[model samples]
Target: MKEYIDRKEAISAIREYRGYFQDQKSTDMMLLKMEAENILKDLETFDIVPVVHGKWIYTGKEMWRCNNCDNEIAGYDKMPSEYGVNYCDRCGAKMDEVEE
Candidate 1:
């Protein structure tokens, strides 16, 4: 399961994790260290709060646009989700009408 945490909480957890490695060593530790640092860097660049969110609105005969980003998305007459798209490919906004 994934836990959503604020910056302070995440920082605290990372610090605690660093402390746990003070005395442990594994043959694969060196290999994983770089990957772990990359993961942390990726976390640091993440947007905890999304800036774009909304649904696709039918704009014309076969055109649909994301209300949040105002970009065209390809889909049939049904909701984009009917075609297995649960997000705005252009803006990364979830296609759900409500946020979880």
Candidate 2:
């Protein structure tokens, strides 16, 4: 049961709250503002997104493309899968899903 939030929206809301309370000088307000600032910092950090996984999609008789990245693999004599690749060479998507 994972949860998610819109990072951009959360950041914006924190910014708005901090801005709205900028004129306050009470000790509790100051501490809350500092916490809000820390929250904004955390919200702005790198995303924890799920890894994009996909299979190879056949595009032509001699070409197959990565479904996650659309990076194409070209072969002259044999299909790309015959080369025994386990991952996409360009985007590094794990090649474990069914080939199309």
Candidate 3:
């Protein structure tokens, strides 16, 4: 069975691999890149996408909040972008002017 890790541990592993490659020689960096790819592949199996944020990798899920009702939504897909901006599902408020 595949070993599952929580989101916090996954982010930490990515950060560690990132730090490991910072000052390495070109040849060594290539090897490190391979290792990093393996880590990313493992994370993919868990439905977690890594996004580079400045110096750290973060979960790619973005949360959108409803300004009218204060409802928060989050997921890899099925986000507000998938739905039309004309209405909010929870409160039926107009969402056309909502900014990303």
Alpha-carbon deviation at 25 in model 3, angstroms: 99
In candidate 2, list every pair of residues with a backbone clash.
none
| Model 3 weakest 10-residue run by lDDT | 50-59
Segments in model 1 whose C-alpha atoms lie over 4 Å from true places: 7-52, 98-100
Instruction: Give the per-residue lDDT of model 2 (tens digit) for 33-87.
Output: 5686677667535467566576777787678888888898877245455578767
Question: If ranked by TM-score, best first, what sequence of candidates would result?
Answer: 1, 2, 3
Residue 58 Cα positional deviation in candidate 3, in Å, after optimal superposition: 15
Query: What is candidate 3's lDDT per residue for 32-70, written digit by digit as tens?
Result: 666765666675554744322111111346656666666
TM-score of each prediction: 0.49, 0.41, 0.29
Candidate 1 lDDT tens digits, 5-82: 565655456544655555657535544565655566577444566445578788876677887889887547877777
- At residue 20, give the lDDT of candidate 1: 50
Better of 1 and 2 by TM-score: 1
Cα lDDT for residue 90, candidate 2: 87
Per-candidate Cα RMSD to the true structure, in Å, reads: 9.2, 6.7, 15.4
Best prediction by lDDT: 2
